[model samples]
Target: MEYGCYVCNKIIKTGEKFTFTKEGPVHMDCFVAAERKKVPEGKAEYLRNLSMILDYELTMLVSLLSLKSEDKETSELIRRRINAIEKQAGETTGLIYNL
Candidate 1:
């Protein structure tokens, strides 16, 4: 079955990851950003922006880490920034690892 993310109203296809929030289906990225608490509740635009930024950061971090395995300090810094996101959530990935 397909569900739409309440924050972005985008279809979350079957087998794709999503969260079941009080508001309804939400993408993993959207749920992560919303849980971060930097944005006020009910503000879809801000949530969307934060969600995209989180996705971008995760992508960049992955690419950078793959190319430069020796940069522990910088990698740790990025990991900290991500961990500061502040909570554990129910996700579909086998890796319970958070950003």
Candidate 2:
């Protein structure tokens, strides 16, 4: 029988299967590591605050760039540059996978 790893999403061929907090299946090795890294729900507020802080920093950077002078030619260049960076970032930071 085969089982699926819930964390890394790899297929478990012969090792023991473990269940995640979200009720997903994983290989024992993967699950153990994930469990070690788990954080308590009470501390989630700290992570949320950190995310908000990072988002504010990103917004400030964009605002500062928007304050710079721009003509049509420069605008097009900026647009293309932003698009390329966004595309690469999206590819590297994709959030979903199915098993």
Candidate 3:
């Protein structure tokens, strides 16, 4: 199948460096320039705040996974309480392979 760059309006040739956005595929340089144009006057304050919350929550999830995998850390003690819901396989019947 054939494809084209979303930003450059040019054919996206084989073996070329490219990336994807929700809009479609684009050359990496075009995608970077397009993204740079979108910031420093970006989304509305409400949307930005929601994005910040999402970023923080994703960090929390990584920390939780580290704990679950028994990685040692000194700084993550504040969130140690999430262990309350941590359960082993079959700790509750039929709860196989909990994340």
- Candidate 3 versus truth, CA RMSD in Å, comes to 14.9
lDDT of 3: 0.47
Per-residue alpha-carbon lDDT of candidate 1 for residues 7-66, written as tens digits (9 for 90 to 100): 788998654545565678787776665565544456555545545654554454444434
User: Best candidate, lDDT-wise?
Assistant: 1
Q: What lDDT score belongs to each candidate, Candidate 1 first?
A: 0.54, 0.46, 0.47
Name the candidate, 1 or 3, with the larger lDDT value. Answer: 1
Instruction: Give me candidate 1's TM-score against the actual structure.
Output: 0.37
Query: Which rank order by lDDT, best down to worst?
Result: 1, 3, 2
**Model 1 spans > 4 angstroms off:** 38-99
Give the alpha carbon lDDT tens digit for every residue of 19-74 in model 3.
44557766655754565455455444433443344334434444555554344564
Candidate 3's error at 84, in angstroms? 33
Worst 10 residues of 3 by lDDT: 90-99
Task: Say which prediction, candidate 1 or candidate 2, comes out ahead on lDDT.
Answer: 1
Q: TM-scores across all candidates?
A: 0.37, 0.31, 0.39
